[model samples]
Target: MQLVVARIGRAHGIKGEVTVEVRTDEPELRLAPGAVLATDPAAAGPLTVASGRVHSGRLLLRFDGVQDRTAAEALRNILLIADVDPDELPEGEDEYYDHQLVDLDVVTVDGVEVGRITEISHLPYQDLFVVERPDGTEVLVPFVERIVTEIDLDEQRAVIDPPPGLIDDRAEIASSRASREEA
Candidate 1:
């Protein structure tokens, strides 16, 4: 399996080290030196990591043969991919690959259908389920343990316990409007 590990960001300094927006949970294993990764833009890499460091809370990597800021600047915005065993899974029971959750039905605890999981949004803080509703609108459901109660792989559904005003806005909107009228 080919999984995305990181995306190359701006050139950090004049020393060929480029800032990286790491995608993997296991960056220590995936982004270490001597790890050769493929790139989205074929010209940017097949990059071999010479060294890595953490500067100002971001990952910085110096690739082999990319010896100057000019060379590093050319690699901006390319995604890095790693070769992995297809059968391998993350160690944690609650963890999952993005591919595994796509296209599943999203429902409330009471079995009320909310939407269909179209994509997984991997933000810095958390992952979100980008769900498409029956009417073609979309909603972002945070993929948190407290809200997402179940993930049934066989049944192909995700059961959620959404907080107030998450799945629906009519109630909150109506309440605000009534308050305005009272004032």
Candidate 2:
């Protein structure tokens, strides 16, 4: 599977250089000259990293075929992807990627299958799972250590002990909060 590692921000210089906002934690280690990256399907075709270097904590990349400012400017907002095997990822006991969690079956401790994970929210402190139930209700379950006790990526299932008042009510709460703020 290919995962996004960076997004082209803007043309950095007049010589076909573009500033890249790297999404990976190890940006310096991941992106380098000769690296092959696939642009997001919505943006354009895959491109090989012609040359790249860290500049001011961001990556300045030059694609193989892109030359001049006009060409580089056309790549802005394009996501860079790399082919990665999920099984090859070195994960700790409880750690998981947002991609791995998406579309996984979410079940309660009592063996009640609740829904499937449709999205993962990156909060300031922790991640949250957005589970879409069969009835179209969305559950916002915090992906905390205690709440999410088990994750089986191979089985595509997750065991969660949702905190009190955290499930099956996100839509109402969000709407109520929005209405209150507006008033």
- Winner by TM-score: 1
lDDT of 1: 0.88
TM-score per candidate, chains pooled: 0.81, 0.61
Report how far off residue 67 is in candidate 2 (Å): 6.9
After superposing all C-alphas onto the true structure, candidate 2 shows an RMSD in angstroms of: 5.4
TM-score of 1: 0.81
Per-residue CA lDDT of candidate 1, range 1-183, in tens?
Answer: 788888999998898999998777677888999999999987777999999998877889999999999999999999999987767778898887766788899999999999899877767678889999887888899999999999998899999999987888555689999999999
- The lowest-lDDT stretch of 10 consecutive residues in candidate 2 is 21-30
